[model samples]
Target: MSHFESCWNPASPQALQRRAALLERIAALRALEDRAAAASARSQAVFDKRGQLLPRQRVALLLDPGRPWLPLATLAGYGQDTPELARSVPGGGMIAGIGWVSGVRCMVVASDSGIEAGAIQPMGLEKILRAQEIALQNKLPFLHLVESAGANLMRYRVEGFVHGGSLFRNLARLSAAGVPVITVQHGSGTAGGAYMPGLSDVVIMVRGRSRAFLAGPPLLQAATGEIATEEELGGAEMHTQVSGLGEHLAEDDREALALAREVVAQLGWAPPEAPPAFAEPRYPADDLLGLMSDDLRQPVDMRELMLRLVDGSELLQFKPLYGAATVCAQARIEGRPVGLISNNGPIDVAGANKATHFIQWMCQLGHPLIYLQNTTGFMVGKDSEQGGMIKHGSKMIQAVSNATVPQITLQCGASFGAGNYGMCGRGYAPRFLFSWPNARTAVMGGEQAARTMQIVAEAALARKGLAPDPVRAQAQFEQTVALFESQADAFHTSGLLLDDGVIDPRDSRAVLAQCLALCADAEARRLRPLSFGVARM
Candidate 1:
């Protein structure tokens, strides 16, 4: 194995400036995330009065202590709740991520009921659906901490109501696939939300607080002059004893969480194998914060970044001379073998062909692929165009699309043009996709986009035999740049759910290891399937 030597200097003025900018970006991401949590935590007094734990508190109590919890979609619906980005809170009124529960790795989703009674926010429905999909894909037990006012009828959209049915359908699918769908009804599940527990394979409800009803007193009284208490309609005791919807009943929030943990423990899941002993990377992971400048246009040695990520800082470079701009290497991350592909510059014809071949070879070897995306795009010029850039680029894309092994992507910097698709961007559905705080994703850089449009405008004016208005054209150029640049920000795209989440650069290795382990476990595990999900009859 060839050990990678680092020439990175952390004390350089340029490096210090880069690190400071990256740190600020990470801090901005954290501040938005903190705002979401604060929004939920504001209702703590109410929760305390009701003898209940906060949504996060409930999640912490249910998860195994000291185990890693990878939070997903922390910026799910930022600015979607309202037009103003600063005032809008993210997280979509939900908390979702992967965590270990009673030694069983499971997908955990909880309704942030503290926020507007946990009414499904703009992207809240999509968030839960994504969680359910991940659980199903990974063969993970689906665990839900339920307490929601269901859809926000006051702000309802026709499309949202239509898409919401998938949530219940996924619950049925999870149970049918033999991946347990477990729900703990902590407070309220009204109207269509009642099916959350109804479709689950196992349900634990808190006695006095939990409620699941098709229609509450007002709706029932309005439709059919019926007078009945909440308990008579769909209280936890009623569901457990009479309706047969709830299997286990707890008196309080803590008891419900304990019951959920105990149920997970009883699932007969085998303990995960202990990881093989491995050496840590030789380079300091902290160097990652300063290694790459904030500007995606500036060139940096991607090999240096890879050295800090892979185990023992060893990499066997593949086809080093053929397409040096596109780096492909064989290495291990946390003892798990991975094929790393990253860009040092725009992919020329040779680089594209190299990547296509490397992708196919890795698939054949059954080693997972990790893409460090930082490319302007495939080389574009007369000579390169004539050299079959399209053909080779397409081949690379096709290979990425059909690769059998799990592919994980990290948008370390620029992800632009077709390069995003060629590198297995979120569109191709990598096993998991994440972004560093400095990552910028767009069709092309703002300057490039603005210049392209300006040239096109000039050509059009020339065709009309008209002179261009320089002042007006300059104004248009600046506006176009601003529009593209603003949307390309990592926080903006992440909030729109373009990627899984924005992560700190320092945490990339740990995050990648956890994701790789998930993929490996999913491959090794076996499941039993049935035609239909278990019904609550």
Candidate 2:
């Protein structure tokens, strides 16, 4: 493989400015994540008094130290919890990630119970479901640090309650798929929540703290006029010894986590060996921070970014001359062969055709595809339309949608309109989707959307023999811009779970390598499927 030469000047004024802007955005993303942590930390005093470890602490103890942990959906319920963006704590009231437990890759989910008594927020349900989906797809063991206060009765919606059934259904599906579902009941699991432990293949409960019951004392008293202590109802001892619900019992959170780790270690699951030695990228990964301007409108060479990502900065260009705007290349990320498709600008007819063919070729070669999305979408114009843009664009989207190989997407800049679909955006169910803080995803730019609406509205007025009101027109335009600008921001979209997570530009190589490694692992692992989930019996 040939090494790529550098054209990036880190000391240049433009580069420095871009780096500064990216750092500011990264800081803001980190601050939002810290807010979720701080919100959970506030309950330390309460947890201390009860002699129980916090939710995060339990997760830390359960996972193997120094191993890579890819946190997913950190912005899951960002602004959904409340209208106030600043006050809204994201993460869907849960901490979840794919990490190693006893050398076995596992999906780790811990309810952020410290917040609102670990109530099941609307997005939290979605977050857990997504986690289960990933675990099942990758054939990873599912380990949950559960201690939810169940659904928030005050803010309950009938739809949320109805959709929540899927959570239990997924657990059963995971088990039936031969993916072990292990639950460490750190706290209350009342009513519908009892199924969490009930459906798991392994249940580890804390003697004093873990409580899993179909009905708690208050409900039991209200309905049956017969009350029992929490211990008698469904405590760890009762579930483990008498009810046969829990298989392992522990005195406190620490031991419970230890037992959970031991269970994973004993599962006899091991990831394939690491790849052979590989050369690092020639360019400094930190330079990625300045590779693209903060503004998506600015054109930057996507090749520069790819050079900093692939091994030894080596890339074999595929059909480079035919579609200059669309770059297709063969590269290796951490020694794992991958095909890369990126956009330097809008994908025109030729670009779309090139990408379509490249995708099929990659699938034939059994190489995972990496999409570096940075397009305003497909090119549009009278001439371009005549050039079969739609026909070609559809072919690209079809290849992306049906590709047998795992596809990972990193939204480096603008991902708008049909380009998102063609490039395997979140909707395509990419094996993993991540975005840089500067990335902007929307149907189109705010101004373009507003102008289109204005033109349509003006045409309607003209048909009615009316004139457009300047004042109303201006007001509508501003409102439309504000709406798109707010939602299209990477932070806002990430918070809404539009992407897996927003990452630092400098970490692109590491992040991509990790994702590629995971894809490789998934391909290598084998599972024994069952018609039915392992029941508690």
Q: Give the TM-score of each candidate.
A: 0.99, 0.98
TM-score of 2: 0.98
Output the lDDT of residue 82, model 2: 85
RMSD of each: 1.0, 1.1
In candidate 2 the C-alpha lDDT for residue 126 amounts to 89
Please tell me which predicted candidate would have the highest lDDT against the true structure: 1
Provide the overall lDDT of each model, using Cα atoms, as 2-decimal numbers: 0.92, 0.91
